[model samples]
Target chain A: MADNETLDAKIEALTAEELARGLDIFRQKLGAAGALWLQTCVHCGLCAESCHYFLTDHEPQSIPAHKLEQVASAFRGRYTLVGRLAPALTGARPFDRDLVRAWVDAAFGRCSTCGRCSLNCTTGVNVPAVMRAARATLTEMGLIPADLQQVVTTALETGNNMAITREDWLDTVQWIEEETQGAVNDPAARIPVDKHGANILFTVNPREPKFFPLGMQASATVFYAAGEDWTVASEGWDLTNYGLFSGNNAEGGAIARNLLDSMDRLGCRTLVIGECGHGFASARWEAAEWLRERPGFRIISFLELMEDYFRQGRLKVDPSRLTDRVTLHDPCNTVRQGGISEPQRSILRRCVTDFVEMTPNRAENFCCGGGGGQLAMAQYRDRRLQAGGVKAEQIRATGARVVVAPCHNCIDQLMELNREYKLGVVIKTVAEIVADALVLPTITPPAGEDHDVTS
Target chain B: MGDAGLRLGVAICAVLAAVALLLQVVRTRSFGTRPPMAEAQGSALRGILYAFGPGMAPSAKESTRTHPVVYALGVGYHLGIFTAFGVLVWSMRDAAAGSALPPAPVRQVALVLTALGMIGGISLLVRRARGPLLRAISIPDDYLANLLTTAFIALAGLRLLAGSLERALLVGAMLLLLYIPLGKIRHCLFFFPARWNLGRHYGRRGTFPLRH
Candidate 1:
């Protein structure tokens, strides 16, 4: 990853040769499904209202269909029959420097690739997939937004996007373990680290250690209450993958491989991805696609695991503990893209006394305007905040005191939105809320044996 | 042109359209569907079924529910196109056999469908031309495609209801058929697969047949 100066110089120096290379990458990435999506769009414009950007900005350029037209037009210009003969008739344009810049703006800055528009598209066009394809081309051309590129570069070079050192991670985990012990009132309770043959190997967003160690303590407390065999790897513990956002499959695959390798080394049978939406989706749904092989171990979201614990009588919660009006902001990757909608709602229902639903929730929920790596792009901060007005209003309508966003990325954006919009809402992760509502059972230590309090 | 020339021209145009559409399909298929390497959390078949079935219902999609009139017009327009094709084939067969128009009931049904289709097509065209959002996104091909299809439907209805202007109807059919593979109208060839792909994606991830 070059400095912004070098990247800008490269963009300014782009020539027809570079344009051809970019177009070649685009053509390769536009697989059959992508081609179908591009060809199937009828310019119905119904997808416009489905987008938070379009709703907030009210700009025609913000419409998903129009934003994708950059890619679609270039694809049609080079590939389709009508476009080849009469490009203007089909609105096809040659891929050039201007188009490259447009791709970056639309694919990265304007859209979050939330798939809300995709779901509502009358033609069933996978809008996010197309945007991702556009992003992939821009990435190959070294045209990604500098801040977003920095995140992906950092994750690839370091083990995590936040670049938290191994020592710092271990120290945070140890401190959180102590907090968990006190919360559970048992010295024997442990946040196990690198314990071989653990049933579950847990992963977390690096933000948990860097900025929100209490989230880790909350998860550890939940694990203790459930008496579960779970271990967190000191290495490869970061679940959030910036590769998915940057559209760099090789880097994404490397990140996923690190986690899988850690799981194997720890001999954990199930990989539990913590409350990171894109991380959960990337690991659960896309890791295999990137790595081209499925892992022997099962991958599940922490929410799902918690749900299982409740179902099997391994964990209990008292909803009366959380009396505040709570609303769950479904992360696009986790609920819409990852298919883990019910477990979170089920958990919320069990853990919160006053749970309110967003008007269009579950698979239909609007994004918090933080996805697709928007939180990392400082250049687009105003646009990102503006787009998030839709989500802020959604939260305002619920009038919930606490907005529970399971994904760390969504949490960050929602926090910013809380300040920008002055919604006066506290943002929380699922683990924190669930930990608040946990009902720990009393266990007695046996004489002459070291008490395994969890068991 | 005479009736014989008109029939021959329409026949040739239909064959050309079919061939062009087939080539497009083959080209699209040449790209090959990437088999998802990830283990399935749910069934792709179920998702695809839902996508083509209940997923298409007005209640299932926000766009359709919000813009019921547009969705309804689009649906009626497509239904009319399909119905008109059937009528065109039947009428061609009758003409070739030197027979009168099909039974009065069949002609009446065709008339009703073609009329509905023409109305839907014209209304949609107006919406596209008038609505700021739609107008911004639409290309010239959109207008041309809509006009050609609506004209074809109108001519088909006239032929069925009045039992005249067979040549004009045939010419309209020929032009519309020729344009099918060249413009935005080509979505007809990719719509099913597009929906199927969308369904399979969500289905395999356990997102479709939404559990909510």
Candidate 2:
């Protein structure tokens, strides 16, 4: 990828003609459902409370309806009959640079695309879907926030968003494999890489190797305990997709295709996305649709796999290790939008001695304010922290010593919230907690042998 | 306009609305070209059913639960609009046959319901007008859509109750019918499908039948 300066120079060089191209791109991105949602909004303003931005900032623009209006107005001006005949009557505004910038700040900077507004919208307007179209519009013009565009560029040019080299990734795996062997006291315990024909080809958030390598080690340990045949590809190991966040489907497709190609070459039958919530949602639920390419293997979150292990007696955890009251923070992408809600809770029940539920959880939980590439967008740092106030308060109310979020992005935001709010809590991922509580069997099971330890 | 002119306007309005509705359907269908091909974890049918079912109840949504009065008014206003449409169609039939109004008791009930609907609609209009956030978000279509439907309900109520203002009621209803296809009021057609889409989108993902 071109360095940040080059990317910025490219974005700054965009012309009005190129920006107009954005509108055409938006027209392409706006699906039938999005059009219906755009027209369906009744301007009720009841969706305000559903947004963390609105709840925290209390700005009119923070309201999802008002935020949507910035894009919907442009859409109506260019497309709708009333807008064409009498723009004022429909409140349609002609697209301009100022309006486009406003849309960027509103759709990308402010909102997290948590889908909360759509859930509470009286008219079912699907605010996030409209906002995503706006993001695509801005992205087509090369007008994305610098950090976000940088991440997308890096992911496109390099294989991972963080641009971690092939040697570095292999080294991390080798290091984590050693740690797993030491902890399990078994030389056979391994964190395999580039093993073809493995049943599971696991992918991790680039942040895992970049910032939190311990979580990666924890995941490897759990897999080792379960005696699962899983391998992380040296290439295409980054599961986090900036393209999904930036609304650049081409980039998203390229990123997803790389993973599919990697899995195919490795002959993996199942792809397991490790503990990164949005990555799991993007790859498992969205990638194929975004790229219009179906993968040959079944894709599932590692949380689901961990839950299966508990049910099948493939892995056992002694919940007594977790003495602190624990709570699960539902990552919006994974829990609400991705349908992986129960699996995490089920895993937590077996991994923790005391697991408490956050009120208004599952699909209704407030976002950690790190979604939609908000964590990577440095421009919105303060706004992101303020938006996390709702989540911080939710955690305070739970009074849990440990907050287990399955998504790495949520863990990042929650950790900041713990510091800012002084909640005095420890944040950990489900895999991390599960790995801690795992009780390895005395006898190592034979390879390819299926044994029910409990049943 | 007199009865003949109003009836002619209503005919024209009906044709325009049909065309507008057809165009919208076609445009939306084009966007709906791609069907979901992902491996289903749960039933979209069940999720859609739930979305339109209990999912729509006031208790099901946070916005509705916290703002009961607003939700109630909105629901009541829509019910009134549906009831008024039935009355308009039935009245149009009577006008064609050169007959009088329905029985006095039925007219009285219609008058009460239409009045209630009018109250609900006016309340919503007032809320929009007063709240700065709402006013900021609203378009001219928002006010016009509310005014047309509210006026239709009010005129219908007056005609049914007083047994007078027949021409005014017919004209108001005709204007509303004409504007429905052109304005935000067309949500009457789009709302159910939008809800169903949410249900299917979230339901197939097993996000619906919301887990605790």
Candidate 3:
């Protein structure tokens, strides 16, 4: 990955033609909602405190409104009468290299697109949407952070961000399936692959197979305990979408289409997105918009599915099995943006005995500083960790020994923050915690009726 | 200028402002929002109600809680602006009809509200200039907009108290109305829609009307 200096040199080398193309893409992406947000900002500065990046450094440039000014300035200069006549008065600037450089840093380096500022904005400006427009523009200019762009390129080329092959993915799944069977003490416990007519088509972040296989094992254990008819696709199994972060709708649409095709192929009743915040958001919220086609199957988060299982009494969990003081780190995409706030809380309450709430939990919770592909952008690692000080403090204040963050991206960052800040805490996923508390139901054969069954 | 000429100037500026703002609304709509293709998990209406209702309450957002005085000043400033507009319309009607001024109680209430608004406007303007965060985000248009509106509010209050600054007040109103579509003052029109858009986006995701 290129450092900031190299990236700056590349940005400086942008040709006039490239800048024009970027501006054209910017105009195309600034639809009504983006226009509204750009126009509505009142510069009240109240949003300054709501942003983790701004709070970390108190730099004026880090302020959400100031960060968005990069895009707003260009929008004004191009579209407005006063801006055309007297750009200085409105702070409008032409779409030039300087603006692009500022935009790349502000939109990609500083912001997580967490939407926390939107909630606090006095005029209700959707700050993140405007930032995304800036990102879309930069993406076209080929100015995406090198590592981040690589992730997107990897996904586009190999069907998963990690570029895991069919062989490797199958190997990981089989390994987790065996682990699930051992943990559940049932030979019939299975992680089915591409099984037709399955009730749920479970998808996972490529990170699960490439690095964090325990998350897969945990999910499989829970599904087995609930006796779910679930299958992981042999292809299109990676739920995480880099397009969401890359701001490339076409690429995002392609990824979403692959999942839709996989669902159709398996004939699943539902598409249960695994514990990836942006992945859940990409599938449940943005996929249809990207594809311009409504999915035939129900799209839900794995957390929501777990909540449903608890509600239906299909899964029994002994909360007493886990006694560690636990606090939940709400992923911004899943809670604040995706609206899957309560389900995870519901699942946690049922799966843990000592649960503590972070001071500002739920939609107001701070970002773990790894959203918007920050984890993938190695160039921004220091800035990301610095901005994560807020979340680190939130966790420390909770005094919890264990932190449960449902999203893999967040888990990765939080784990780093734990080491960086020396917070001395274990980070686990909701599925992992629930797996610990899972109580397998005793199956008493009904007068030898099921004596020869798989169990 | 003569009384008649001042009144006519104010009227023309108001009309032009309205037409310009309407055109802006059309232009904004011209960018046409993509109809959400996903299945909605909650009612957009419910979310919109929350956005305009409880969502605006100080308790509902950290911004307001942290800056209660600034929020109050903003609220008062807007209220005063609305009240000044009402008084302007009432004065125009009475003048055209050759009738007496508003009842003393109505006049007094208007005076009090406009006075609060005038103070809010001045205070906010000062905050904008003094506060580093606000100053950094502000452009020339912001300060100009605040100045024009604050001046208009002050003149309106003076007209209510002394009933002699009608010409000055009319000129202030005319300048403000003319500047509305040319600067950040247009946010007066975009605020509601922006809030609506925010609500609808979150509502569709079942995030707003926030469930506990």
Candidate 4:
């Protein structure tokens, strides 16, 4: 606690002028939206436990509601008389460096910005919106935590969240294509690239193209086998918006704006987002809302895409390929924010014979530790999994060995939970199952020799 | 301004509410709450009831420990709205004595309530907008809730201070009954019921029972 005071002093000592300048920029950028958030808080704390930081740590300060108060009260004290009275009456304290740093960690790193808390809040006070304003204020002050700084720099330079180079992105896709051929015997599967006017534009998180290419491999094989007229963007198409991780909506908007406009330019009908929870949430939810007007493009998750394929008879399913009993783990963004759970159920029903339902399967789905950019933050690793204990227990109750999460973030966190708890459960991507079980049409080759990747 | 106006106003409001309920009822049946069923009505009722009883200073349904000033202010504000609304109701029968809902004395009380509620709400809003992490996460709805609630209160005060009591009464009643089903006002009714249902389900499952 003594160490905390030193840092607090350092933060408090910042000139009011500097703080004012940052606030000025925020005011200029925020305009009416800023005022709206300032006017709406009713002091109900329903959003407290929705935060992973608060849930895992059980710290009131970490709760999204409390965090909002810290920033909100300061705003109140400076601007409104009643706000002043409440703070004075209610122990409104001043901000210090320690509080700022802690807030950075909790709001930016620990919480996934899933917007679940906002949905549940009675007053409709969006905590993430307040958190983003605070984030911009902090960011302007050059107080952004180093790790997130690194991610932003990487993303700006590489056009991917993990900062994968363009060459690496292509190479990763190539490796996945090869693996797809080896696994599904479809080398000439021909994953379309920059194919304008395609019906679907499939996108993956940079992680899929970097470390876990298997997810990409699975999705590619599934799309090909299902005879999808899908294409991927060669430039500015990386959909995982890290700006969302820091609650930086502008950068998030910038990241997603390209894809939305790209879809328009390419004349695509729908978007098949990859297996990312926050990426899916950020791209499909917040960023789209910020487009000033609706972008007129519809987004469907890969799982939902699979569900549509089966419902439309675009793909024939064979459940025999999936050998174990499986239960569905709905990623919060995919379920709570995305509203894409039925397709998940449909995919499971078509791909696995031994299927069981988790108690909270849909909108009330527990968040994966990796969602809301919690995984990207890199500091809250333990809290991410520990906060996920409730979710693990839900799965355990199902008595299923294979846990199929339709999200990349869920898959990542579930993988860690599998090792930590040793629940004897293996996590599988929905894409993996759908691809393995999907019936594919015979691949026709030109006058080719025995060397053929497409089966 | 007289019994006729008052009767007509309530009838119109009742009709509007019926229409809103019909739409919501239809929507609830078709799509409902996307996927997982939450005990929103049940939980909200429980939360509100618990609030009245043990009334976790800041309310147990909420986890944040707001300033007691804020809580008291909130209670005061809601009470003001309630009283102000009551006065307006009385106005419907006696036009010159007042206009729509209640008399001058009753409207006065409503004004006070609206004022108090606005003070507390605006206080909280300003605090969050300028404060640390909250201002960061605050979206438009958050500010808009306070902005509109305050506006309604200010407008109530203005109308009482000047405008025809009947006009104020009609607008107030229509807004309360009509928008309650549409906007954030849904919380007043939803808070208790939603929290109650959530508590029941969680309790049955041996999940966390929300205690004040």
Candidate 5:
């Protein structure tokens, strides 16, 4: 939608339109739970132990309810009486720009906005609504984090966050195809980029090209084996939007638009967000909504895709492919926001013989402590590991040797979890499991599906 | 104040006041929970209402099955307290007869029983702190509010235990009443409307039903 601008250029070229648009994200979200968020409570303390961040950090200050209080306190002071009278006593303080900015950063920039807290909030305060309100404020405050801000700017400018040249995207796909072809016996494997009107318009974070190409290769192998016709966008691609994590709702909305518009133009039926956690979480649950419409295509995860194949009897899991004891770490967004507990469990059940269930599994599962740009913030590693302690404990209790996280952030966090707690639980994606569970000389193609859609 | 009168009055009033406050804290503690840094941001007045709770309102999302006990308890306890509070706030004459509102015996009994009920709640709060399940939740305020309020009540209770005068205890009661408008205790006045509004709003949004 715009041209590439370096960080300095972006700073120099900031327009009133962008400024106004960014700031409005906050106001639009305010009456969000309409300040009912301001009202509901009994202060039961039931949610204290529900959060991994609170538990691991053991900072009484970090408790989910206490964190929620910052907003609640503001709401009371701004809108109600007792807040006006005894603001500090009741913990309700008058809202100022600094407080608003702090809230924006804490809720949007710092918090995963993961909705995990809401799941456990006994009052049903909808912490996400609170978080959205804060995010809206951040959107207004012009406080978007630079990393995500840049990604959004790039996506809006060059049609992709990584600014991956068309040649590079094509070359990456070709490289994946070639890698999969060499590794497996599937000579007919296809890496379909820019195919129009396909069932799925699959996209991934540019990190796949930049750092983790095997993920792309592995996914291509799965798609090739499954005989699915999924296309990648020639431009306006890459599904990852760090902006959403960083609390830049406008940026989040914009990045989403770039991808959705491409999918719409190509007339794809579904948008399969390849395996990045925050990106998948952003595009599906949030960005789509912010754009004022459903996404151009139904967005499904690779885990969902695998579940479909397993359920439909299209793919066979040999079970012997994985010798490690595996447990699934349901990404908070997928499990909590997306309500994907059933499909995730189904996929895990089919592939791993030794599947261990963490106590608060499913939607109630702990965050990677790395979601919501936490991992993206390399500076926050100490806090991340400390916050991840509970999860590390849960994994250790399972005695599982490996963690099969379906999201990228979860994988990274679990890696850190393993190292910090010394749990020795190796982290992997569902694709990694499928890659192993798959035992053919190559993924055996269904009948009459040898022709590449790209052909 | 004579020792007999002072001891008796302070003991009874302190017990009454302490129990009332302890109950207040207990009741306030039930208004959902504290998530990190996210307190309910209703105006201070409304927040105080929610901390006290509106009398026995049910949120829209509140399922009859899951909340059957709560609904029953809330109606009985909060309604009793509301009725008691109404009588106390309205029935303010020195004499038992010719008062504009219901007399102190009825109000006093309501207050005392309400205090006892609150004591039960405070006891539950105590158990929450003591129990392993909730020990980690035993925060400074969680424990302090109940114990402090209980002391005020215990002083009143000690007066009741000793059968002591009424003015000093009355002043103690007044002091607490004044404090309610300012302290975390303000939830006493604000919890009801705040929670009801929160419930109703979320309910309307189809996320959670408004509590009636």
Candidate 6:
């Protein structure tokens, strides 16, 4: 008991220095757009209902505006004269251990950084940006949950969050390649690795090779059907970055640089991100910002590539086989933030005979409660599950037998929701659905040639 | 006659408010000027238009649609505040030239609008105080700002109803005008730029002009 008290005293003593540094980091984050958001909020509380956390728990602390105050109030104390001189007048409070702990939980655990509340903000305050500043500050103070820190550390050390070895990755890929060939009844099918000058350099959620190898197989089958030349890199194949989740810019930049270097080495034309929403959205769009350089080649999601194939009439799929009513859960990162909403719907429309949309679908869809690294942070699992109830109800209302989410995280969470809620639905990625209904053309491509379509 | 002092006080307060607001604008702009590193996927012009245009439509937002009455009241309150500002300028112009008040018809219209705004503003305050979430999120500045603005609007309406209250109204307006930079009410100055940046950010991401 004395040792525990001593440890607590040490932690409490560290707060003052940590807070001063955290304030500096947060102040640095407060660029013009961020400052405007911080200053413009009126505390109108309209965003309370817009937050899934508040919706589920009805806790005022779950209010998006209050979560923002955690960051903005600190800024107020440090930057504003009124806050400096008369802190109470402006609701500014000095940082302490309790404040830091509260902010870490509210900013990282309770919230999904889903960008939902911002859509309804009357003054158009960017709630997610403010939340991100809080996360970044907490990260600077080394207050990130152990689970999130482990993911970031593993990614930095092992080039993937799951720490899967090259031998394991290769074995899984080769086995899936064989399985895909047998499933398609075409011995020529392959999941090419390290092929030079391939049209597409594909990256998948590490979860794919680690646990869900069939998901990668489905994606490869679609590429094979389209007769497209694609290769996965032996190095830097993990496209997902926990940095975005952890609010560590350096880690995110490193992840982007690694992928760009890999793409350059392989001489691939397009970087195709796989069926993971946040990873696809972050790497394809946001990573460039962290790296601050244009990645010479185009970045495209697998959904977009499939949509292109469908538009070009290259890959034929028999939708009659997918007769169950299917509903799509738009991943917040991919659809709302990434702007890849239409392509998934377009793919699903052709890939499924019966396709329905969840109410308030598209960019406005509720999160699957697994985003913002919630799935990785075990401490927040109960809160995540409760927040997911909003999405569960939306799916239940659709009465769809199959739920098609193009995001791997959403798929994982929805699978859990299905079991918990007894929704009696199967969860599938867009690629998996396409793979299930793919119709192989009569004329096949040679084993090692770029696709040449004349249709 | 002695209203010149009141009119001069309002002018001085307005000038101070404008100067403070300008410094804030400069500080905010200086930080936000870093160009976005991401490639633009959609037209920023379209996004700005959507942000100010249809985006402001109550139907375009869930909060607005869910609480249409509160949204309408809030909109009405802002309209009243803007209208009061116009009255302040008009009354000041008349005092400067030592001219007569505007035709009673215009005064009546102004009076009705300012009264409506006061009602909206006061009801919003009551609502904020009553709700658990609102009370938790609100700071002292929120209540003070709303109360001051609502009181100013009420004073303006009373002055329009009876010209004898002009001095009180001007004093009330001056207090709000001076306090704008120090409190939450200053959202008036930042609201447009905030929305513009929002439009640009969302617009660049192809998330703006939010398609159904």
What is the per-residue lDDT of model 2 for residues A1-455, given as tens digits with 9 covering 90 to 100? Answer: 53334445555666777767777888888888888888888889999899999899889989998998898888888888878888989888877766776787788888999998888888777777788888987777766777888898898898998888999889888877777777776767788888999989999998888899889989998899888999999898888888878988888988888789889889998999988878988898889888786777799999999999888998888999989999999998998778888889989888888899987798888898999889988868899999999999899998899999999999999989899999999999989999899998776767996644331
User: All models: lDDT?
Assistant: 0.88, 0.84, 0.87, 0.63, 0.59, 0.85
lDDT of 4 at B61: 30
Candidate 2: deviation at residue A326, Å? Answer: 0.8
Scored against the native two-chain complex, candidate 1 gets a DockQ of: 0.76
TM-score of each: 0.96, 0.94, 0.96, 0.66, 0.69, 0.95
Q: Write the per-residue lDDT of candidate 1 for residues A1-455, one digit (tens) a residue.
A: 43444556677799889888888888777788988898889888989999999999899889999987878899888888789899888898888767777787789879898999988888899999989888888888888877888888788788888898899889888888877777786878898999999999999999888899888889999889888998999899989887888888898999998899999899999999999999998999889988989899899999999899889988788999889999999999999999899898888999998999998899999999999899998877899999999999999999899999999999999999999999999999999998998888765556675744342
Docking quality level of the chain pair in candidate 3: medium
Q: Cα lDDT for residue A114, model 2?
A: 93
iRMS, candidate 2, in Å: value is 1.4
Model 4 chain B lowest lDDT segment of ten: B32-41
Give candidate 5 regions above 4 Å deviation: A1-28, A85-89, A96-105, A108-110, A439-455, B1-116, B121-212
Q: Rank the candidates by lDDT, best first.
A: 1, 3, 6, 2, 4, 5
Instruction: Give fnat for candidates 1, 2 and onward, in order.
Output: 0.83, 0.75, 0.80, 0.03, 0.05, 0.78
The DockQ figures for the candidates are 0.76, 0.71, 0.74, 0.05, 0.08, 0.75
Residue lDDT tens for model 6, B1-212? 37888888999999999899878877876554567777778778888889999999999988898999999889879878987887778788886665435678888888778887987999999999998779999999999999889988887777677775778778888999999998888788888889998898888888888977
Q: Which 10 residues in a row give candidate 3 chain A its minimum summed lDDT?
A: A446-455
Stretches of candidate 3 off by over 4 Å are: A442-455, B97-100
> Could you list the chain B TM-scores for each candidate?
0.93, 0.91, 0.94, 0.63, 0.45, 0.94
Model 5 per-residue lDDT tens digits across residues B1-212: 54345335534653565565455444434333422121111243443343234312344122322445534443444443454334333323322344433444654665565566456445655665665534442334344444444444543433333334234344444554544433445455344444444444223222221112
Give TM-score values for chain A, per-prediction.
Answer: 0.96, 0.93, 0.96, 0.86, 0.85, 0.94
- Quote the positional error of residue B108 for candidate 6 in Å: 2.9
Q: Find the 10 residues in a row with the least total lDDT in model 1 chain B.
A: B25-34
Worst 10 residues of 5 chain A by lDDT: A1-10
